[model samples]
Target: MHAWIIWLPVCEAGRTFGMDSLGGWMFWIVCVCFSVWENAALKVNMRESSLEVVRGDSVILPCSFYTSSRLSTLNIIWTLARSSSPETPIQVIVYDYGQVIEDPSLIGRVAFTGLPLSADIILNYTRLSDAGTYRCMVNNLPEKADPGIGELELSVLEPPSLPDCKWDGDINLGGSVRLSCSVAEGVPTPDIRWEKVNPEEIPLPINMEGDFSGSVQIVNVSSQTSGLYRCSATNIL
Candidate 1:
């Protein structure tokens, strides 16, 4: 007797495992030896080094500084450098001599929520493109102190909007059956895969008649391919 399996993706976890629409961003800041760079009396106080946020939402990257005495002039600069091209850092915003200069590329998208003495920045309406590393540096020219540089990482995520699995044609022994799966939406890219629940009979994965993802062809079916066929959608945020 020939065998074939049918997979059904009927788990709620697959729908909403890591992402829940209302995303949670874990904000963190990696200290670049604040105590050593600046005077022990004056340093930067960062709350978090990493954060996770949902797409289409605004997140406040928490950051502040500690100062011992007042300074004449302060220079604050915020920069972002994507992993793809780390050498060239994009100047997001800058504050100097009581004057503010925001990069045209991020005119309305970025803002300096905190004062010059204590630097804090807020990113508005973040998307997958905004996911990258951020740096905040302050230079108290009068004090001649080392620049206080803090690093923060941001991750944007979105749940798979629509996921489905369907059979191409009749599932017959010695014939061919194609299963194609796909998802409607996923940020930072979504992964789609096919699986068979029952292990007693396993079918071979072949190149089916589809040029898209979540597509696999099983040729020369035997009694082994008679089980549950399932498709799962998820983003590795």
Candidate 2:
């Protein structure tokens, strides 16, 4: 009868464990297994789940994790999806395991501020495309259930643009006339209004092409309507 003996390394303080007597290949295999077990016991932490920001600004996505055991190699992975579904294609933002790899999708615009425990990411010069949901996942298998999320809704707001005023018909007695107003560009689509320059009971407003253009029909044109007309364009931020 033959007896075989095996030497196993002891892992304490919740850190990856290996033996110096063994070669590097054997050390890594043991390390991976310890990592998987430790990850299962980890707990996740999150600060904020929703955020709102304006265009051309900066925003932060917060996520965090804690474990009693120490990890020799920690991987902080951030992915983007339309919602909180795992089926969606993940846009990798920051991946740190043994090496640090930055996804091209970030394009130098995304930065990782949370170090070691936190996986928060900051986006600079935000645009309309940035509006959506994101998920933060850790390499903690078995323990990894639902990932932390950061959902942001971006609004692009700008003041009303240059306005144009026109009339439906010429000024005449006992004739119907409509004042049309419009603007070239507006963020929330400007609201057009018509007011008598001198101020009087003008006809009720009727929108033409959306609220960008509006007109009011004067049933009976008279000298009282002879006042100059002013058109103003305003938008909701």
Candidate 3:
């Protein structure tokens, strides 16, 4: 934020005043223009405010800042509100006067990946415990401006676990069959699919009923329907 100011001074009279004339009063018009930097503080920006990465993978939290001061005077700090303590943020890393100080817990798992005026960082070997909120702070000395801050929410994904498949029905020719599948645990609910996989690999008998959530039903089974079936569950990590 900025403001402009104009100063205008008018003389008291056209004639110059002397020591005895009008009590030595003299004035002249003076014009001046200046700017006031009231809100010229640093600004921080994030390319992506929220991000997700698979467990064990590396991810980058992007951050940048704008400031009128020199980059050499910049100081950066990154903090995390880990899952264990959502309300309390711990300092993860700091960049001060060309030196870096990292937290012991993140000494080997995190790295600064940005240049001057940027706070981008990468987290390596991510884990479910790493999912949390992160903050990036930057300040330039001698500016007396507010520090630039950016925030990001991180999510470490867990892949779908193995699925359990079962069937309930008699082997009789006219018996109805219900094939069901389920995944006991996964970060995101896995998608379930059933497919016929035997006897020349033909498609599942038509008119099958059931939703993708995990089950399929076949009515009036026949010898032609006899085959191997498979159930699969999957989700992106």
Candidate 4:
């Protein structure tokens, strides 16, 4: 009976060891798979964070990373890849590994002025011809890391100037004449006003058209109405 009890306990111990061995192997396999997956994911994430900018104005593109705190030694890069053509490169705007990479096209134009986790890149003096999609790339980071991308749309507008005023109708005696005042190409629209310098000093009949065009008519033209008519236009900055 003593030998029988001892054999039963030995059998139970063997079974427990076998199960534990299997569990340990499975755990190791899972850990290895997760490590590989995490590296790949970080690589992808770094590639996704890269971005671009326009020519005439300023643009801020963010490039950041999220990974284990121990991997903070990773590098960051920002490049301007031409739209639709990745092989033909325009310029490397910024490449910040431990320090910043200086490129001629981005001289005094690009700046990286934010923390590593939240990078704020500023590009100034954007132009209309610089309108295109840009690719911002962050490289040499961990796998599964995605780089940031930004698209900029730039528009250039020439400021409005004072337009020439001319008499649209014949200025005749005893007949009404229409003097039109106009200004071209303003954002907020220009102000138009007409002033009559005559003996009567009466306000001329003024009709405005869409903030830019204005017409003033002098009725019952006489020698007394023979005075200088002035049309003034002021643009809104």
Best by TM-score: 1
Q: Write the per-residue lDDT of candidate 4 for residues 1-237, one digit (tens) a residue.
A: 011111112246455444444666666766776776565533223233333332344766544545553444545555554444546656545545557764677678777776455444666785433334455554444443443343332233334457667775555777876677777754435667777755544566679877678887767777777787777666434
Q: What lDDT score goes with residue 185 in model 2?
A: 64
Clashes by residue pair, model 3: none
Choose 1 or 3, whichever is better by TM-score.
1
Question: Where in model 3 is the C-alpha error above 4 Å?
Answer: 1-38, 71-73, 83-85, 144-147, 164-185, 193-229
Off by over 4 Å in 4: 1-36, 43-59, 63-89, 125-131, 141-237
lDDT of 3 by residue, 155-217 (tens): 888877787777899768998988877776666556667788876654443222333247778
When sorted by TM-score, best at the front, the candidate numbers are 1, 3, 2, 4
Candidate with best lDDT: 3
Q: Give per-residue lDDT, candidate 3, residue 215.
A: 74
- Candidate 3 local Cα displacement, residue 195, angstroms: 6.0
Q: What C-alpha lDDT do the candidate models reach, one value each?
A: 0.68, 0.65, 0.75, 0.55
Angstrom error of the Cα, residue 18, model 3: value is 16
TM-score of 1: 0.63
Query: How do all models score by TM-score?
Result: 0.63, 0.60, 0.60, 0.44
On a 0 to 100 scale, what is the lDDT of residue 47 in model 3?
83
lDDT of 1 by residue, 51-160 (tens): 98898788887767765456557777888886657778888888887888888977787787867556787878876767788887777653543437788998887877
Across 73-182, the per-residue lDDT of candidate 2 in tens digits comes to: 56677666543253565675755654556667667778778576577778787665555566676654334434433343334445677888777875688888877777
